[model samples]
Target: MKESFNKNDYGFWNSPFQAKDLASKSISFTDLFIDNGVVYWGESRPDEKGRNVIVSMHPDGSIQDETPPEFSVGTMVHGYGGGAFLVKENQLYFANSKDGMVYHKNLNTKEINPVTFPFEGRFADFSLDSKRKFLYCLRKNDSTQNQFPPTEIVRINLVTKETEVLFTGSDFYSNPSVSPDGKKLCWLQWNHPNMPWDNNELFVADISSENIITNSKKILNSSVGACYQPIWSPKNELFVTFDGNNYWNIYKIVNDSFEIILEKKSDFGRPMWISGTRTFSFLQEDILIVTFCDNGMWKTGKIYLKNNGFVEINNNLSTIYNIAADNNQFVMFAGNSLLALAVVSSNIKEPFKFKILRKSLDDSFPSNYISEPKEIEFTARDNKSVYAFYYPPFNPEYLKDENNLPPLIVKIHGGPTANVDCLMNPKIQYYTSRGFAYLEVNYRGSTGFGRSYREELKGKWGIKDVEDCLDAVKYLIQKNLVNKDKVILAGSSSGGYTLLSTLVKNNKFLCASCTYGIADLIAMTEHIHKFEAYYDQSLIGGSILTDKELYFNRSPINSANEIKTPIIFFHGDKDPVVNVKQTEKIATALKENNIYHEVYIFSGEGHGFKKAESIVKVLDKELKFFQKYLSN
Candidate 1:
């Protein structure tokens, strides 16, 4: 029963892909931690108001009782939080997002109590000391008056409810790890001018007789490029992942000098957007397992320290997001083209046979409708080659005429700094299954290629991104691969900005649909949070004070009067990233200019849409609008 070639034709929205499917589909796992024999993870469930629920998995692959329905274990570290929950034995320590307080719960007694005093401080990246009855963590004080948020390391007396500052004087701090004997502490720090991924240092200090850190020294200097994730081996040797050579590789410190342990031209680490992240861990004293992104796909492998040999882990997963390991096994949240995101555990020796503990995909979804993307590379502006995942309309039941090209949707991913991975994203397939060709472009600034490629958009954000996106659409049309007249542009967050900017500047697309998107570059600086206060300076080349005209000229809203095509804007009323006012202003401009437009504001949603009903309504509206405008 092979699909299509022997069957009838089916088109976009003609199959089982539904708008409700997007509402229920949740982000798999943000972070994972393993303790004793259980694995704990934070899940972003939109059905639950996008609450980050903490779930535990047993060794036998059984689902344990999740965190109390009232408690969603998440941290507000750096605005985008990871390392939210940590578990030691039957004890659970987590930062509650609602209150910004760290709470401890006894798994046996089912009792939860706050350990830190209530304040505006957010605590995360928990490091437990089994022998000292204390827990160490990174804390960020969100001060209202101060321009820069202050970060410090603090230790909490679990029993006494006392908090003591261990270290301070850093603009940002993360990964505060304590040695097994609880005698030494090590962590990562960086300043305001540079983000963690750009430059950082590792520090280590010995514990004193009075239970205070004494005589700390910088083990990894910032001049040596970005270094982070310092972990003391069982033999007390320090190992870290650094991008000293433009490639984030594993290095072990020997006599205060780095000794390359696992050499590869791939990223063994990721951008430090949050407090805690891990790419590898010691599977045993002599063996370590790690995951790295070579191009855009993720793969896992184990390094044998004894022989300095590397062996790839044989698995069906295309992406290994988070990994945690013990002496005998490794657990991770991984995904492939066929399977939705799932939490799976594998034995250290085999590393192939996996047992699924939990998954995001349900039985109701149609696997046949999922569109498998084709890797595409097209020459763009400045003679630079751009990359994208081009997915044509796919349905097992549908066949189409070769000459009757399908409509196209050029999707711009958010995080103008982020890149898309090779995985089965149902949201992307939603359009492809309905007779729409989809393209997820990797512009110049997107990561995963190399440091040089990522830095290409440093001061060319709006220009390069807009040029490359339009180039992608034009590339497909020239080859007669798509319907030139029905091509549309869409994206969220920064992606939305790129889409709208393209629509306004080139007047090439039929219409544009953006969600919580940025329009006014100058206004973005006023609305963004502390984590990204000077972000525009890096992307736009100068502060608002120095380049007022440049910001105004690049803003898409300034060209709203030039827009003759219909546009629809979706914004969260509570969004703080790019404030709700930015989108509202564009909507106002569109209406005043007599342009066909629609605006839907979700009340409780924040920077990103979070509720199931909200996701459903916005998506349905966007699809209907797409259909209405494309019909013309």
Candidate 2:
């Protein structure tokens, strides 16, 4: 019998959505907490109203009903106001997004009560100083002005209903970890013009009996690079992971001095900012089990603090989002073939048992049929090393001619700073299975490599990222893995900007496609979300008025005359990040220039393609466009 693959298997299957269209699905891990001998994890489900819901899952692989508490409505979905649930004894305390208030829920009584605090801000984490009866939280001030200072740390007395500001600044603050003894508080902070990966400071403060912050000292600030994801050792000694000197390494504070624990060129931290959660699991003994992503694959390893060595435990998992450990056992949310819990002995020896919680894909697409991506490193124009995942063309039904290598689609990930990992991305598979080789580029400014490499595209966003894509294409052609004449460039958001810039800068690409991409830097800077309003300051430089020529030089819309490749553009009418007007202006220019181009706009979608129908349509249109232009 022939194996069958269902392309339209759309529903919330794995985390909340099916694996085939996971790329477009709005899924995130939330409410990871230990409760009643089981670990509970909450996830956001897709809904028309964009209501943020949390799904509770047990460590033994049991999922509870999708809980959409009354507070989820009208909350920001993209990294905004969703509360992190914390269960203490029989009661649960979590922040309510609806009113920007913190609430407590009784698991035993099923009763919910609002904690008396009048504040209009998003609350992230809460650390209870049990001895002093104080709750420390990282709160983002929701003052609606044209601009304001960054987020701050606050402390609240649960009994008195009194709130006190612990720390305030222009620097963004997050991940407040109170020491095991509740004597010292540790947190991470990063300033403007630099994201967390660019530069950050680790601070430790003495917690007074009155819940006041005292003797706050910068424990670890990156002199050469940035420090992030500070995790305190069980003994209350400061342990932090930082990319100092262009390499991510683990360091411990001993006698107020830094001691290198584990050093590697690979990344222990993810590309994005770290949530207030544990990355490393402390076992029964002194075994430090941590998950790290190298190249693109994620591995769970055990680090011996005494000998300063790490041994890989599970090498098959693509990404381990979270890890939890108890006395004699350990559990982790391991990703790859499935999102499941890996139960193992505290020693981490012998066979581990995996309880599958979520399976993204069906069994129809077997391992042999799936395309395996190979890591490729090439030199860019500045001799900088660029990393990319090259997925070779593979289709059981398709027969290929000897001379006809598969068409290539070069994918530029958004954030330009975000590095594409080896996740089981069906978006890439959708093209690869149809005989298109896909290359996802982690160009300069992409995190995971280190600070120096990430800052390589600081003032050269359009130029450097474009060059990296071109260089990757050249490398593939030289390796004979892809057809040089049939190479197309594709990206969304920042990647979309890179795609457009590549089309204008070079004529090598036969076609270019972008979704909600920026065409004008000036327009983007003028009208952008508050989270990244000053993004251009770090990306391209000052305002268009201050650096007029630089803005024009970086914007593909200004250099559209140089673009000879046929372009396809997709934008959402509701996209506030990269406004649809950017695409409209470019489409108008394309029409005036008589450049063969097409633009598609989704009515209510935002920066990303959200709706299932919209996602399928975009994929279909993109594939058809490439086939029409490149294949012929």
Candidate 3:
């Protein structure tokens, strides 16, 4: 008789109605729009205005609310800076980075108008080309202007409010699409030593009719892989989704060659970059539905092209987030582990019709204190295979007995080629409910398996993600489920540079933590940020003045006097991506090599950790620094 889920039985363990009250008791579906005959989504309501207001559901069903603007006191920075509606002809157009302006409602006179651009940036993809009267937009520049440059691809002129700069990116620009006679303009670029699923570039241009940008082309660059979402097929052809031979398939561009149309092993990009959405949804005239990433969930299928086949239509959707379609219906933003909205109808025996619009919390936590992860698969030291999630410590209020077995940690996910899924992250359930047993590790340069396992971490980033995170901590202490002297190891920026290069080149991490990570890969290729300033020429290859000893032998503060574990860190004194002097030069080389380390810093935060008492004081100071050195 042990059953107790607390924090008001279920609401406050880092609330937001805990993934919409676990997606309304697990039926799931939310925020996936298409207006009028109804479909509009965004939900997560338990009050204090963290998320909610914006709901609709018709198509002979009937349901409409749209209740935003309430929880005042800086309402979570104005509902996390709202705006992203765009429903043409019925007029909606949105992008109110909390009144930075670009509004225009009407849905039949619900009335609202705002538009007055001068660019304070962050309004991605809007198009009204209406035969070039112009209104094209796609701005991002998250300016703090340390000498201006972060991301851009502008265009605005709803009849001369004028603003141009068709392309100006040192890295990052996404899904611009446009071209059903808009005179061509595709997008999607990546730089930063790489991460857009590890490599990206699709780009296309030639517009001018006074919208400018008359010639530009890079149409698909690959030096071995990574290309991303760049759609444009309604008979204009020019689709894309690369990771060529390592698996993320779907390519088109006929006559000029580049053909594969849907190969698979999973992942179709999207772990970041939302807004200006579109995951292959052409709908009719020979159908094509697309959305991929299989094992780490999120799936959607249906690409017939007269029988080239692939009919998956939804395989237990898990936090889809967006996908819209026409030719008779299809609107998802799905959910199963909470996050909602689903509707499907192309008559393939219709039945999917959900509408949970945000549940925000009710079951009061206690599926044994929430810890359900298991995807595991190991192999790596170049033998390859690697993929992980693990998690294990079922917390009956943090109890453990039958011969104790918990202390583990590991983690490492910061685009060391990202891939940690099964969303609902209470910061990884506040450390397996407190007994602790995590893992995460999607090593081998992670990115949903394909493209030769993301080029096996090219020239091996800090030696293949620190030898596949020490062979997943020696396959979890040889399956004893962790306890080989309480192993630890965490990560942040580049998984905090592979947790200080695996505790200064392994002795089996008995301690290590990081955030705003990276400790000098030649001073992060001379001051990071310029979209990864040529990411050490593709993961540490040379040019720290031509590979200064492979950037000081793959920096961990140049082997911090060969560490010896105990490291903990966390930064953010305005961290513009891994720089708080890379954790104060590894806390001054763990205090001139006498070793034992710990550092904090936050103030005004940046590079991750946005308020809410700095994410509950950085997860309660990394759970009291892993219970002061793994509990003993």
Candidate 4:
């Protein structure tokens, strides 16, 4: 292990974790589950042009890629897809990214067949009926002219090879969890003007012998708050996480009333950004293996239904994703700041004893070369508390002058609704290992915190989020931890909005990088996808019609003349969200204003860069841009 700290190390130390490792070697695992003693997950390979391959691990610890190279296991449902695949009785069903059709693969025979015809729409959040004769999922129809599409819970008859719409009325539907006995069906639904995390309803219906859904009734209406992950227990009981008391807690629907199963100050549920996100799984009829966010860190535990008691499972992992119960054990993808993301499993009784099935980064670096983050809470401009993770410069091999301070990199996470955790992110480590002081600001509006804090950015979108980012830098500079003149701003998506807004509002940083970020809120509202059509309305105070001035005024593109800091923008020409034109328009305005700026449009890339070459180019250019500006 390399020594963790050496105050003598220079500020611009060299790191072995180069941009190549970050782009090509650091793998990302998502949508994990287990079936019939086999662990399965969606592995994204940058080297393969960001192809998502379905991988499976057998009981004997044998691993193999299940999907063929031509077939990438992904979907475009709701624009941001998840729950792309499911397995049953050796039959693998997955949505193909190329055609938006669901495919079936016989694990035994390795024969691939298309289950659904090619269409403009997509299918996700897959669920199978009791007899496996029908597949249930949320089917999104994108042919509509409206930005928001008409989504329905549909059942596909496997024997007949036909699709049947089971339920339709809501603007969006997800999490179609059939009862273990197959007699009842439960799912979540929310309409326009309200995002899933803002407000949604949970419904349950009786399933007829003929496979028709009837007697549909709302079981829980989150009119005041939000609800997520409605799942059925082994004994046919229904449970979900509700954020009625500011914090998302586990609740059980009993006699038409929600009974708190476990109450905590932390959030048991996260923002419903994608489909098929599972935070908890039933290990048995009365036990649940779960993960929750506590103070920005995700922790796993066991919940006893009968006693409403909980026991913290000491798995060293601070970030856990896509958990599924497998017999008496649970399998998941999890890792912390110092650990690489891996496919891990543990017995319900001994949940801490993790068995690593696979690792994204197989090779480990010297301990001293890594810089660990320290969680910090600072007061915002409004006196509200803002949380961030601070990582100081660390390089054991080099030494720096005692009087000098390191340059700062303020990383703002996207989502505006999402929060960052202590994950082993190769991207963050890429800069920190090179002696940059990194800070990830969990601004108000970010999840993981209580509902009140998360809602603070509502109606204040660009304003408060921008304030928090600026406040974080001011706090660091006041503490003498970072040089104010050498600070760099970086963010993507909504975070990019905050970055550009900050640069326009104040000139506290040297240079900044924006990736597929929003520059014109007005244009974004017009080009926004169906899933988040109304997201800006809630965040920015009102719709385009109601608050047109606010939209134009909050947009960074409108105030490009106010920006003096140099910036480099990376955007995907085919991005569905935050149209590439947003970046182009802003760059044009900057050019007219004679402000230093550059824009790189990558071909075939989208909201997030997936190709290794694109990732490498962005990082390489960003490093040089920041270094050049810092030196000046």
Best by TM-score: 4
lDDT of 4 at 75: 82
lDDT of each prediction vs. the true structure? Answer: 0.80, 0.68, 0.63, 0.86
The parts of candidate 3 lying over 4 Å away from their true place are: 1-86, 89-124, 129-368, 371-394, 397-405, 410-484, 490-493, 505-530, 535-543, 546-550, 556-632
Which window of ten consecutive residues has the lowest lDDT sum in model 4? 1-10
Q: How many angstroms is residue 410 displaced in model 3 relative to the true structure, after the best TM-score fit?
A: 4.5
* Candidate 4 structure quality by residue, lDDT tens digits, 447-517: 89889999999999989999998899999999989878788999999999999999899986789999989
Model 2 C-alpha lDDT per residue in residues 164-204, reported as the tens digit of each score: 78788645776787887888998877676666666677788
By summed lDDT, which 10 consecutive residues of candidate 3 come out lowest? 71-80
Report lDDT (Cα) of residue 196, candidate 2. Answer: 67
- Rank by lDDT, highest first: 4, 1, 2, 3
Residues 444-491, model 1: lDDT tens digits: 988777666777888787889888888888899898888888888888
Model 1 spans > 4 angstroms off: 1-12, 25-27, 143-148, 220-224
TM for every model, in the order presented, reads: 0.94, 0.86, 0.31, 0.96
Estimate, for each residue in 539-618, the C-alpha lDDT of model 3 and write its tens digit.
77667766688888778787788887777788879776567887898889889878777788988676765444555566
| Model 4, residue pairs in steric clash | 8-399, 8-400, 9-398, 9-399, 9-400, 10-399, 10-400
Candidate 4, residue 465: CA error in Å? 0.9
> For model 4, what is the C-alpha lDDT against the true structure?
0.86
